[model samples]
Target: MRDMKRIGNDRVTSIGLGTWGIGGKEFPDYSHDREAIEALRYGIELGINLIDTAEFYGAGHSEELVGEAIKPFDRDELFIVSKIWPTHFGYDSAIKAAKASAKRLGTYIDLYLLHWPGDSFEKIKQTLHALEDLVDEGIIRYIGVSNFDLELLRRSQEVMRRYEIVVNQVKYSLMDRTPEETGLLEYMKKEGMTLMAYTPLEKGILARNKCLEEIGKKYGKTAAQVALNYLIWEDNVVAIPKAIRKEHVKENAGAMGWRLSKEDRERARLCV
Candidate 1:
Protein backbone atom coordinates (compact mmCIF):
# COMPACT_ATOMS: atom_id res chain seq x y z
CA MET A 1 0.00 0.00 0.00
CA ARG A 2 1.13 3.55 -0.69
CA ASP A 3 1.58 6.07 2.09
CA MET A 4 -1.96 7.20 2.84
CA LYS A 5 -2.68 10.91 3.25
CA ARG A 6 -3.83 12.40 6.55
CA ILE A 7 -7.30 13.86 7.09
CA GLY A 8 -7.47 15.25 10.64
CA ASN A 9 -6.43 12.22 12.72
CA ASP A 10 -7.21 9.50 10.17
CA ARG A 11 -5.22 8.13 7.22
CA VAL A 12 -6.78 8.04 3.75
CA THR A 13 -5.66 6.59 0.44
CA SER A 14 -4.14 9.43 -1.57
CA ILE A 15 -6.33 8.31 -4.46
CA GLY A 16 -9.78 7.75 -2.93
CA LEU A 17 -13.02 6.57 -4.55
CA GLY A 18 -15.70 9.00 -5.77
CA THR A 19 -19.20 7.53 -6.23
CA TRP A 20 -21.34 10.01 -8.17
CA GLY A 21 -22.71 7.83 -10.94
CA ILE A 22 -22.23 4.40 -9.46
CA GLY A 23 -25.71 3.94 -8.01
CA GLY A 24 -27.10 6.87 -10.02
CA LYS A 25 -27.06 10.63 -10.22
CA GLU A 26 -29.99 12.75 -9.04
CA PHE A 27 -32.39 9.86 -9.66
CA PRO A 28 -31.94 6.16 -9.08
CA ASP A 29 -30.63 3.90 -11.83
CA TYR A 30 -30.11 0.23 -11.11
CA SER A 31 -28.88 -0.87 -14.52
CA HIS A 32 -25.38 -1.63 -13.26
CA ASP A 33 -26.00 -2.12 -9.57
CA ARG A 34 -24.10 -5.39 -9.30
CA GLU A 35 -21.10 -4.07 -11.22
CA ALA A 36 -21.08 -0.93 -9.07
CA ILE A 37 -21.07 -2.90 -5.85
CA GLU A 38 -18.34 -5.20 -7.13
CA ALA A 39 -16.26 -2.25 -8.31
CA LEU A 40 -16.54 -0.62 -4.88
CA ARG A 41 -15.56 -3.81 -3.08
CA TYR A 42 -12.68 -4.28 -5.51
CA GLY A 43 -11.36 -0.78 -4.84
CA ILE A 44 -11.54 -1.34 -1.09
CA GLU A 45 -9.71 -4.63 -1.47
CA LEU A 46 -7.02 -2.89 -3.53
CA GLY A 47 -6.41 -0.56 -0.51
CA ILE A 48 -8.49 2.49 -1.42
CA ASN A 49 -9.83 3.36 2.03
CA LEU A 50 -11.65 6.66 1.48
CA ILE A 51 -15.04 6.51 -0.24
CA ASP A 52 -16.76 9.85 -0.97
CA THR A 53 -20.47 9.92 -1.70
CA ALA A 54 -23.39 12.30 -1.22
CA GLU A 55 -27.06 12.09 -0.21
CA PHE A 56 -28.10 13.86 -3.41
CA TYR A 57 -26.38 11.12 -5.38
CA GLY A 58 -28.96 8.54 -6.52
CA ALA A 59 -31.46 10.44 -4.33
CA GLY A 60 -30.10 8.52 -1.33
CA HIS A 61 -29.70 5.25 -3.21
CA SER A 62 -25.90 5.77 -3.45
CA GLU A 63 -25.74 5.62 0.33
CA GLU A 64 -27.82 2.48 0.24
CA LEU A 65 -25.48 0.82 -2.26
CA VAL A 66 -22.51 2.00 -0.22
CA GLY A 67 -24.08 0.50 2.87
CA GLU A 68 -24.44 -2.76 1.02
CA ALA A 69 -20.91 -2.77 -0.49
CA ILE A 70 -19.06 -2.57 2.82
CA LYS A 71 -21.06 -5.18 4.72
CA PRO A 72 -18.29 -7.78 4.43
CA PHE A 73 -15.39 -5.48 5.34
CA ASP A 74 -14.24 -4.21 8.69
CA ARG A 75 -15.90 -0.80 8.97
CA ASP A 76 -13.13 0.66 11.13
CA GLU A 77 -10.50 0.10 8.41
CA LEU A 78 -12.36 2.31 5.94
CA PHE A 79 -12.88 6.07 5.85
CA ILE A 80 -16.34 6.97 4.54
CA VAL A 81 -17.35 10.47 3.43
CA SER A 82 -20.94 11.52 2.74
CA LYS A 83 -22.48 14.95 2.18
CA ILE A 84 -25.87 16.39 3.14
CA TRP A 85 -27.64 18.30 0.41
CA PRO A 86 -28.68 21.99 0.66
CA THR A 87 -32.30 21.06 1.36
CA HIS A 88 -31.08 19.36 4.52
CA PHE A 89 -29.14 22.34 5.86
CA GLY A 90 -30.50 23.51 9.21
CA TYR A 91 -30.44 22.59 12.87
CA ASP A 92 -33.18 20.03 12.56
CA SER A 93 -32.83 18.91 8.97
CA ALA A 94 -29.05 18.57 9.19
CA ILE A 95 -29.32 16.21 12.12
CA LYS A 96 -32.13 14.36 10.41
CA ALA A 97 -30.11 14.07 7.22
CA ALA A 98 -27.06 12.82 9.07
CA LYS A 99 -29.11 10.17 10.81
CA ALA A 100 -30.69 9.17 7.53
CA SER A 101 -27.30 8.86 5.84
CA ALA A 102 -25.86 6.97 8.83
CA LYS A 103 -28.77 4.60 8.75
CA ARG A 104 -28.28 4.04 5.04
CA LEU A 105 -24.55 3.42 5.35
CA GLY A 106 -25.17 1.07 8.30
CA THR A 107 -22.28 2.85 10.02
CA TYR A 108 -21.35 6.32 11.20
CA ILE A 109 -19.85 8.50 8.47
CA ASP A 110 -16.16 9.28 8.94
CA LEU A 111 -16.47 12.66 7.29
CA TYR A 112 -19.80 14.45 6.90
CA LEU A 113 -19.75 17.48 4.59
CA LEU A 114 -22.21 20.16 3.57
CA HIS A 115 -22.82 19.41 -0.13
CA TRP A 116 -22.45 23.07 -0.99
CA PRO A 117 -22.28 26.58 0.43
CA GLY A 118 -26.00 26.71 -0.33
CA ASP A 119 -28.19 29.85 -0.25
CA SER A 120 -28.09 31.20 3.28
CA PHE A 121 -25.22 31.80 5.67
CA GLU A 122 -27.63 31.55 8.58
CA LYS A 123 -28.63 28.11 7.40
CA ILE A 124 -24.99 27.18 7.04
CA LYS A 125 -24.40 28.24 10.64
CA GLN A 126 -27.31 26.18 11.83
CA THR A 127 -26.05 23.15 9.93
CA LEU A 128 -22.57 23.48 11.37
CA HIS A 129 -23.96 23.58 14.89
CA ALA A 130 -26.05 20.54 14.11
CA LEU A 131 -22.96 18.74 12.76
CA GLU A 132 -21.16 19.47 16.03
CA ASP A 133 -24.13 17.94 17.76
CA LEU A 134 -23.94 14.93 15.48
CA VAL A 135 -20.30 14.53 16.41
CA ASP A 136 -21.20 14.28 20.11
CA GLU A 137 -23.99 11.88 19.26
CA GLY A 138 -21.51 9.63 17.37
CA ILE A 139 -23.22 10.09 14.04
CA ILE A 140 -20.15 11.60 12.29
CA ARG A 141 -16.47 11.60 13.12
CA TYR A 142 -15.39 14.77 11.24
CA ILE A 143 -17.00 17.76 9.55
CA GLY A 144 -16.18 19.17 6.10
CA VAL A 145 -17.52 21.25 3.19
CA SER A 146 -17.58 20.69 -0.55
CA ASN A 147 -17.51 23.09 -3.51
CA PHE A 148 -16.70 25.92 -1.08
CA ASP A 149 -14.62 28.93 -2.01
CA LEU A 150 -12.14 30.69 0.26
CA GLU A 151 -14.68 33.14 1.67
CA LEU A 152 -17.25 30.43 2.33
CA LEU A 153 -14.61 28.20 3.91
CA ARG A 154 -13.65 31.01 6.32
CA ARG A 155 -17.28 31.72 7.12
CA SER A 156 -17.96 28.04 7.77
CA GLN A 157 -14.92 27.91 10.00
CA GLU A 158 -16.11 30.90 12.03
CA VAL A 159 -19.36 29.16 12.94
CA MET A 160 -17.64 25.87 13.77
CA ARG A 161 -17.41 25.40 17.53
CA ARG A 162 -16.25 21.88 18.34
CA TYR A 163 -14.81 20.19 15.22
CA GLU A 164 -12.48 21.56 12.59
CA ILE A 165 -13.50 21.86 8.93
CA VAL A 166 -11.03 19.30 7.63
CA VAL A 167 -11.77 19.04 3.91
CA ASN A 168 -12.93 21.13 0.96
CA GLN A 169 -13.91 18.85 -1.92
CA VAL A 170 -13.71 20.87 -5.13
CA LYS A 171 -13.08 20.46 -8.84
CA TYR A 172 -9.33 20.33 -9.34
CA SER A 173 -7.16 18.75 -12.04
CA LEU A 174 -4.33 19.56 -14.39
CA MET A 175 -6.96 20.43 -17.03
CA ASP A 176 -8.72 22.85 -14.66
CA ARG A 177 -6.34 24.70 -12.35
CA THR A 178 -8.91 27.21 -11.06
CA PRO A 179 -8.22 26.40 -7.41
CA GLU A 180 -4.54 27.18 -7.80
CA GLU A 181 -5.28 30.28 -9.87
CA THR A 182 -7.71 31.56 -7.21
CA GLY A 183 -5.34 30.69 -4.31
CA LEU A 184 -8.00 28.48 -2.70
CA LEU A 185 -5.58 25.56 -2.63
CA GLU A 186 -2.94 27.67 -0.92
CA TYR A 187 -5.35 28.97 1.69
CA MET A 188 -6.52 25.48 2.53
CA LYS A 189 -2.90 24.38 2.90
CA LYS A 190 -2.15 27.32 5.22
CA GLU A 191 -5.15 26.45 7.37
CA GLY A 192 -4.23 22.74 7.56
CA MET A 193 -7.25 21.60 5.54
CA THR A 194 -7.28 18.95 2.83
CA LEU A 195 -8.09 20.00 -0.75
CA MET A 196 -10.05 17.02 -2.05
CA ALA A 197 -9.74 17.22 -5.83
CA TYR A 198 -12.82 16.00 -7.68
CA THR A 199 -12.96 15.47 -11.45
CA PRO A 200 -9.23 15.13 -11.33
CA LEU A 201 -9.23 13.52 -14.77
CA GLU A 202 -11.27 16.35 -16.33
CA LYS A 203 -14.00 13.78 -17.08
CA GLY A 204 -11.53 11.50 -18.89
CA ILE A 205 -9.78 14.11 -21.03
CA LEU A 206 -6.55 13.22 -19.27
CA ALA A 207 -7.23 9.55 -19.82
CA ARG A 208 -5.59 9.80 -23.26
CA ASN A 209 -3.69 13.04 -23.22
CA LYS A 210 -0.65 13.40 -25.45
CA CYS A 211 1.34 15.32 -22.86
CA LEU A 212 0.50 13.15 -19.88
CA GLU A 213 1.00 10.06 -22.02
CA GLU A 214 4.50 11.24 -22.91
CA ILE A 215 5.25 11.73 -19.22
CA GLY A 216 3.78 8.36 -18.34
CA LYS A 217 5.98 6.59 -20.89
CA LYS A 218 9.05 7.52 -18.86
CA TYR A 219 7.49 6.06 -15.67
CA GLY A 220 5.62 3.11 -17.26
CA LYS A 221 2.25 4.60 -16.20
CA THR A 222 -0.90 5.54 -18.09
CA ALA A 223 -2.03 9.07 -18.88
CA ALA A 224 -4.70 8.87 -16.20
CA GLN A 225 -2.13 7.74 -13.66
CA VAL A 226 0.14 10.63 -14.56
CA ALA A 227 -2.70 13.10 -14.19
CA LEU A 228 -3.88 11.73 -10.85
CA ASN A 229 -0.27 11.72 -9.65
CA TYR A 230 0.10 15.41 -10.44
CA LEU A 231 -3.01 16.24 -8.42
CA ILE A 232 -1.77 14.53 -5.24
CA TRP A 233 1.82 15.82 -5.75
CA GLU A 234 0.97 18.41 -3.14
CA ASP A 235 1.06 17.16 0.41
CA ASN A 236 -2.28 18.78 1.31
CA VAL A 237 -4.13 17.51 -1.76
CA VAL A 238 -5.96 14.22 -2.48
CA ALA A 239 -7.57 13.29 -5.78
CA ILE A 240 -10.92 11.41 -5.88
CA PRO A 241 -11.67 10.25 -9.43
CA LYS A 242 -14.76 8.10 -9.99
CA ALA A 243 -14.08 4.84 -11.79
CA ILE A 244 -16.70 2.08 -12.08
CA ARG A 245 -14.60 -0.36 -14.07
CA LYS A 246 -12.19 -2.71 -12.32
CA GLU A 247 -9.35 -1.74 -14.69
CA HIS A 248 -9.81 1.97 -14.01
CA VAL A 249 -9.80 1.43 -10.26
CA LYS A 250 -6.59 -0.56 -10.48
CA GLU A 251 -5.02 2.11 -12.70
CA ASN A 252 -6.06 4.87 -10.28
CA ALA A 253 -4.57 3.04 -7.32
CA GLY A 254 -1.24 3.04 -9.16
CA ALA A 255 -1.16 6.86 -9.22
CA MET A 256 0.14 6.99 -5.67
CA GLY A 257 3.10 5.02 -4.12
CA TRP A 258 5.57 6.96 -6.26
CA ARG A 259 6.75 10.52 -6.72
CA LEU A 260 7.30 12.50 -9.89
CA SER A 261 10.45 14.57 -10.09
CA LYS A 262 10.26 18.38 -9.82
CA GLU A 263 10.87 18.95 -13.51
CA ASP A 264 8.27 16.36 -14.60
CA ARG A 265 5.69 17.85 -12.20
CA GLU A 266 6.30 21.29 -13.73
CA ARG A 267 5.91 19.69 -17.15
CA ALA A 268 2.54 18.29 -16.10
CA ARG A 269 1.46 21.72 -14.83
CA LEU A 270 2.00 23.00 -18.34
CA CYS A 271 0.26 19.99 -19.96
CA VAL A 272 -3.07 21.80 -20.12
Candidate 2:
Protein backbone atom coordinates (compact mmCIF):
# COMPACT_ATOMS: atom_id res chain seq x y z
CA MET A 1 0.00 0.00 0.00
CA ARG A 2 1.07 3.64 -0.57
CA ASP A 3 1.05 6.47 1.93
CA MET A 4 -2.42 7.63 2.92
CA LYS A 5 -3.50 11.09 1.81
CA ARG A 6 -5.09 13.51 4.26
CA ILE A 7 -8.81 13.91 3.66
CA GLY A 8 -9.87 16.36 6.35
CA ASN A 9 -8.26 14.66 9.39
CA ASP A 10 -8.71 11.12 8.07
CA ARG A 11 -6.17 9.37 5.82
CA VAL A 12 -7.20 7.37 2.75
CA THR A 13 -5.54 4.84 0.45
CA SER A 14 -5.03 5.85 -3.17
CA ILE A 15 -6.43 2.52 -4.26
CA GLY A 16 -9.34 0.92 -2.41
CA LEU A 17 -11.53 -2.19 -2.57
CA GLY A 18 -15.09 -1.63 -3.75
CA THR A 19 -17.19 -4.24 -1.92
CA TRP A 20 -20.40 -3.66 -3.87
CA GLY A 21 -20.18 -6.78 -6.02
CA ILE A 22 -19.07 -9.04 -3.21
CA GLY A 23 -21.56 -7.68 -0.68
CA GLY A 24 -24.58 -6.76 -2.75
CA LYS A 25 -27.22 -9.07 -4.22
CA GLU A 26 -27.80 -6.63 -7.06
CA PHE A 27 -24.85 -7.80 -9.17
CA PRO A 28 -24.33 -10.51 -11.79
CA ASP A 29 -24.92 -13.16 -9.12
CA TYR A 30 -25.36 -13.21 -5.38
CA SER A 31 -22.11 -14.61 -3.96
CA HIS A 32 -21.90 -16.44 -0.65
CA ASP A 33 -20.68 -14.70 2.50
CA ARG A 34 -17.65 -16.95 2.85
CA GLU A 35 -16.47 -16.11 -0.64
CA ALA A 36 -16.98 -12.40 -0.06
CA ILE A 37 -15.07 -12.55 3.22
CA GLU A 38 -12.20 -14.34 1.49
CA ALA A 39 -12.06 -11.68 -1.19
CA LEU A 40 -12.02 -8.90 1.44
CA ARG A 41 -9.27 -10.59 3.43
CA TYR A 42 -7.32 -11.20 0.24
CA GLY A 43 -7.65 -7.55 -0.71
CA ILE A 44 -6.29 -6.50 2.70
CA GLU A 45 -3.44 -8.99 2.45
CA LEU A 46 -2.53 -7.42 -0.89
CA GLY A 47 -2.06 -4.01 0.89
CA ILE A 48 -5.43 -2.54 0.05
CA ASN A 49 -6.41 -0.78 3.30
CA LEU A 50 -9.37 1.24 2.06
CA ILE A 51 -12.75 -0.47 1.84
CA ASP A 52 -15.85 1.13 0.30
CA THR A 53 -19.26 -0.28 1.14
CA ALA A 54 -22.85 0.93 1.48
CA GLU A 55 -25.67 0.28 3.94
CA PHE A 56 -28.04 -0.58 1.09
CA TYR A 57 -25.78 -3.36 -0.23
CA GLY A 58 -27.75 -6.44 0.83
CA ALA A 59 -29.52 -4.16 3.33
CA GLY A 60 -26.46 -3.96 5.63
CA HIS A 61 -25.16 -7.49 5.03
CA SER A 62 -22.25 -5.96 3.08
CA GLU A 63 -21.07 -3.94 6.06
CA GLU A 64 -21.26 -7.04 8.23
CA LEU A 65 -19.05 -8.94 5.81
CA VAL A 66 -16.58 -6.07 5.62
CA GLY A 67 -16.43 -5.91 9.41
CA GLU A 68 -15.59 -9.60 9.67
CA ALA A 69 -12.93 -9.41 6.93
CA ILE A 70 -10.99 -6.57 8.57
CA LYS A 71 -11.45 -7.82 12.14
CA PRO A 72 -7.89 -9.15 12.47
CA PHE A 73 -6.19 -6.01 11.15
CA ASP A 74 -5.38 -2.99 13.25
CA ARG A 75 -8.25 -0.55 12.91
CA ASP A 76 -6.00 2.42 12.15
CA GLU A 77 -4.39 0.58 9.24
CA LEU A 78 -7.69 0.73 7.35
CA PHE A 79 -9.97 3.49 6.19
CA ILE A 80 -13.56 2.26 6.18
CA VAL A 81 -16.26 4.16 4.27
CA SER A 82 -19.99 3.51 4.06
CA LYS A 83 -23.04 5.28 2.64
CA ILE A 84 -26.54 6.17 3.81
CA TRP A 85 -29.48 5.54 1.50
CA PRO A 86 -31.36 8.53 0.08
CA THR A 87 -34.56 7.55 1.86
CA HIS A 88 -32.81 8.48 5.09
CA PHE A 89 -32.73 12.17 4.27
CA GLY A 90 -33.59 14.15 7.42
CA TYR A 91 -31.24 14.57 10.36
CA ASP A 92 -33.06 11.96 12.43
CA SER A 93 -32.94 9.25 9.74
CA ALA A 94 -29.42 10.18 8.66
CA ILE A 95 -28.17 9.90 12.22
CA LYS A 96 -30.04 6.63 12.85
CA ALA A 97 -28.92 5.10 9.55
CA ALA A 98 -25.29 6.09 10.12
CA LYS A 99 -25.32 4.52 13.56
CA ALA A 100 -26.75 1.29 12.12
CA SER A 101 -24.07 1.22 9.44
CA ALA A 102 -21.35 1.89 12.00
CA LYS A 103 -22.62 -0.91 14.20
CA ARG A 104 -22.74 -3.32 11.27
CA LEU A 105 -19.26 -2.17 10.14
CA GLY A 106 -17.89 -2.93 13.65
CA THR A 107 -16.04 0.38 13.95
CA TYR A 108 -16.41 4.10 13.45
CA ILE A 109 -16.89 4.83 9.76
CA ASP A 110 -13.91 6.92 8.62
CA LEU A 111 -16.02 8.52 5.92
CA TYR A 112 -19.74 8.53 5.25
CA LEU A 113 -21.39 9.79 2.08
CA LEU A 114 -24.88 10.47 0.84
CA HIS A 115 -25.53 7.58 -1.54
CA TRP A 116 -27.54 9.68 -3.99
CA PRO A 117 -29.46 12.91 -4.23
CA GLY A 118 -32.93 11.96 -3.17
CA ASP A 119 -36.35 12.88 -4.62
CA SER A 120 -36.02 16.66 -4.32
CA PHE A 121 -33.31 19.30 -3.87
CA GLU A 122 -34.74 20.30 -0.47
CA LYS A 123 -34.31 16.78 0.88
CA ILE A 124 -30.75 16.69 -0.44
CA LYS A 125 -29.95 19.91 1.40
CA GLN A 126 -31.48 18.63 4.62
CA THR A 127 -29.58 15.38 4.33
CA LEU A 128 -26.27 17.10 3.72
CA HIS A 129 -26.79 19.38 6.68
CA ALA A 130 -27.54 16.31 8.75
CA LEU A 131 -24.33 14.64 7.59
CA GLU A 132 -22.35 17.71 8.53
CA ASP A 133 -23.85 17.49 12.00
CA LEU A 134 -22.65 13.89 12.22
CA VAL A 135 -19.10 15.13 11.70
CA ASP A 136 -19.40 17.59 14.57
CA GLU A 137 -20.79 14.86 16.82
CA GLY A 138 -17.77 12.63 16.08
CA ILE A 139 -19.87 9.98 14.34
CA ILE A 140 -18.23 10.39 10.88
CA ARG A 141 -14.84 11.94 10.26
CA TYR A 142 -15.58 13.11 6.71
CA ILE A 143 -18.63 13.57 4.45
CA GLY A 144 -19.10 13.16 0.69
CA VAL A 145 -21.64 12.71 -2.08
CA SER A 146 -21.99 10.03 -4.77
CA ASN A 147 -23.42 10.07 -8.30
CA PHE A 148 -23.62 13.85 -8.31
CA ASP A 149 -22.92 15.93 -11.42
CA LEU A 150 -21.14 19.29 -11.79
CA GLU A 151 -24.06 21.48 -10.78
CA LEU A 152 -24.99 19.34 -7.81
CA LEU A 153 -21.31 19.13 -6.88
CA ARG A 154 -21.16 22.91 -6.67
CA ARG A 155 -24.34 23.16 -4.64
CA SER A 156 -23.17 20.46 -2.27
CA GLN A 157 -19.88 22.31 -1.96
CA GLU A 158 -21.74 25.36 -0.73
CA VAL A 159 -23.34 23.32 2.05
CA MET A 160 -20.29 21.13 2.74
CA ARG A 161 -18.11 24.13 3.53
CA ARG A 162 -19.49 23.91 7.07
CA TYR A 163 -18.00 20.43 7.52
CA GLU A 164 -15.46 20.21 4.65
CA ILE A 165 -16.34 17.46 2.15
CA VAL A 166 -13.26 15.50 1.12
CA VAL A 167 -14.41 13.12 -1.61
CA ASN A 168 -16.99 12.44 -4.32
CA GLN A 169 -17.63 8.81 -5.24
CA VAL A 170 -18.83 8.29 -8.79
CA LYS A 171 -18.79 5.73 -11.61
CA TYR A 172 -15.64 6.48 -13.61
CA SER A 173 -13.54 4.24 -15.80
CA LEU A 174 -11.79 3.97 -19.18
CA MET A 175 -15.11 2.93 -20.75
CA ASP A 176 -17.13 5.70 -19.06
CA ARG A 177 -15.79 9.22 -19.56
CA THR A 178 -18.90 11.05 -18.38
CA PRO A 179 -16.95 12.65 -15.51
CA GLU A 180 -14.50 14.14 -17.99
CA GLU A 181 -17.32 15.27 -20.30
CA THR A 182 -19.30 16.85 -17.46
CA GLY A 183 -16.28 18.65 -15.91
CA LEU A 184 -16.75 16.85 -12.57
CA LEU A 185 -13.10 15.79 -12.54
CA GLU A 186 -11.85 19.31 -13.11
CA TYR A 187 -14.24 20.70 -10.55
CA MET A 188 -13.14 18.20 -7.93
CA LYS A 189 -9.49 18.93 -8.68
CA LYS A 190 -10.11 22.63 -8.27
CA GLU A 191 -11.77 22.02 -4.89
CA GLY A 192 -9.06 19.63 -3.66
CA MET A 193 -11.58 16.78 -3.49
CA THR A 194 -10.72 13.18 -4.24
CA LEU A 195 -12.84 11.50 -6.92
CA MET A 196 -13.19 7.86 -5.89
CA ALA A 197 -13.65 5.76 -9.03
CA TYR A 198 -16.21 2.99 -8.49
CA THR A 199 -16.85 0.55 -11.32
CA PRO A 200 -13.30 1.46 -12.30
CA LEU A 201 -12.94 -1.62 -14.52
CA GLU A 202 -16.27 -1.10 -16.30
CA LYS A 203 -17.30 -4.45 -14.77
CA GLY A 204 -14.43 -6.10 -16.72
CA ILE A 205 -15.25 -4.77 -20.16
CA LEU A 206 -11.87 -3.00 -20.48
CA ALA A 207 -10.09 -6.19 -19.46
CA ARG A 208 -11.17 -7.83 -22.73
CA ASN A 209 -10.43 -4.90 -25.02
CA LYS A 210 -7.95 -5.74 -27.79
CA CYS A 211 -6.18 -2.36 -27.64
CA LEU A 212 -5.62 -2.65 -23.89
CA GLU A 213 -4.37 -6.19 -24.25
CA GLU A 214 -1.82 -5.18 -26.87
CA ILE A 215 -0.64 -2.19 -24.86
CA GLY A 216 -0.56 -4.16 -21.62
CA LYS A 217 1.66 -6.91 -23.02
CA LYS A 218 4.28 -4.33 -23.96
CA TYR A 219 4.53 -3.40 -20.27
CA GLY A 220 4.10 -6.90 -18.83
CA LYS A 221 0.65 -5.99 -17.49
CA THR A 222 -2.86 -7.28 -17.91
CA ALA A 223 -5.50 -5.33 -19.80
CA ALA A 224 -7.34 -4.61 -16.56
CA GLN A 225 -4.13 -3.38 -14.97
CA VAL A 226 -3.58 -1.06 -17.91
CA ALA A 227 -7.05 0.37 -17.36
CA LEU A 228 -6.50 0.84 -13.60
CA ASN A 229 -3.12 2.48 -14.17
CA TYR A 230 -4.76 5.11 -16.36
CA LEU A 231 -7.20 6.15 -13.61
CA ILE A 232 -4.62 6.25 -10.78
CA TRP A 233 -2.25 8.35 -12.88
CA GLU A 234 -4.55 11.33 -12.80
CA ASP A 235 -4.07 13.72 -9.85
CA ASN A 236 -6.57 13.29 -6.98
CA VAL A 237 -8.04 10.25 -8.73
CA VAL A 238 -8.35 6.87 -6.97
CA ALA A 239 -9.74 3.61 -8.33
CA ILE A 240 -11.51 0.82 -6.41
CA PRO A 241 -11.85 -2.20 -8.73
CA LYS A 242 -13.84 -5.07 -7.26
CA ALA A 243 -12.23 -8.50 -7.54
CA ILE A 244 -13.56 -11.82 -6.29
CA ARG A 245 -10.50 -13.94 -7.00
CA LYS A 246 -7.15 -13.68 -5.22
CA GLU A 247 -5.21 -13.49 -8.49
CA HIS A 248 -7.40 -10.65 -9.72
CA VAL A 249 -6.99 -8.85 -6.39
CA LYS A 250 -3.20 -9.03 -6.74
CA GLU A 251 -3.46 -7.91 -10.36
CA ASN A 252 -5.55 -4.86 -9.41
CA ALA A 253 -3.02 -3.79 -6.76
CA GLY A 254 -0.25 -3.94 -9.41
CA ALA A 255 -1.74 -0.69 -10.74
CA MET A 256 0.26 1.22 -8.13
CA GLY A 257 3.81 2.70 -8.39
CA TRP A 258 4.71 2.81 -12.12
CA ARG A 259 2.66 5.02 -14.42
CA LEU A 260 2.00 5.01 -18.16
CA SER A 261 4.05 7.37 -20.25
CA LYS A 262 2.35 10.49 -21.63
CA GLU A 263 2.01 9.08 -25.13
CA ASP A 264 0.67 5.75 -23.85
CA ARG A 265 -1.72 7.54 -21.54
CA GLU A 266 -3.07 9.62 -24.39
CA ARG A 267 -3.42 6.53 -26.55
CA ALA A 268 -5.23 4.71 -23.76
CA ARG A 269 -7.46 7.72 -23.26
CA LEU A 270 -8.36 7.71 -26.92
CA CYS A 271 -9.09 4.00 -26.80
CA VAL A 272 -11.28 4.41 -23.75
The residue ranges of model 2 lying beyond 4 angstroms of the native Cα positions read: 1-6, 26-31
Candidate 1 residue-wise lDDT at 38: 91
Please, what is the TM-score per model? Answer: 0.98, 0.94
List model 2 lDDT by residue over 1-272, tens digit each: 56355566666666788888565675434557778789889888877888999998888888998999999999888888899899888878888999899999888888898898877887778778888888888778888889988898888778754877788899999889888998999988888888999998888899888898878887898889899888888778888887767788888888876778888888898776
Per-residue lDDT over 55-148 for candidate 1, one digit per residue giving the tens place of the 0 to 100 score? 9888888888889999999999999999999988999999999999999899999999999888999999999999999999999999999999
Residue runs of model 1 more than 4 Å from their true location after superposition: 26-28
Model 2, C-alpha of 169: deviation from truth (Å): 0.7
True-structure lDDT of candidate 1: 0.91
Candidates' C-alpha lDDT:
0.91, 0.83
Q: Candidate 2 lDDT (Cα, whole model)?
A: 0.83
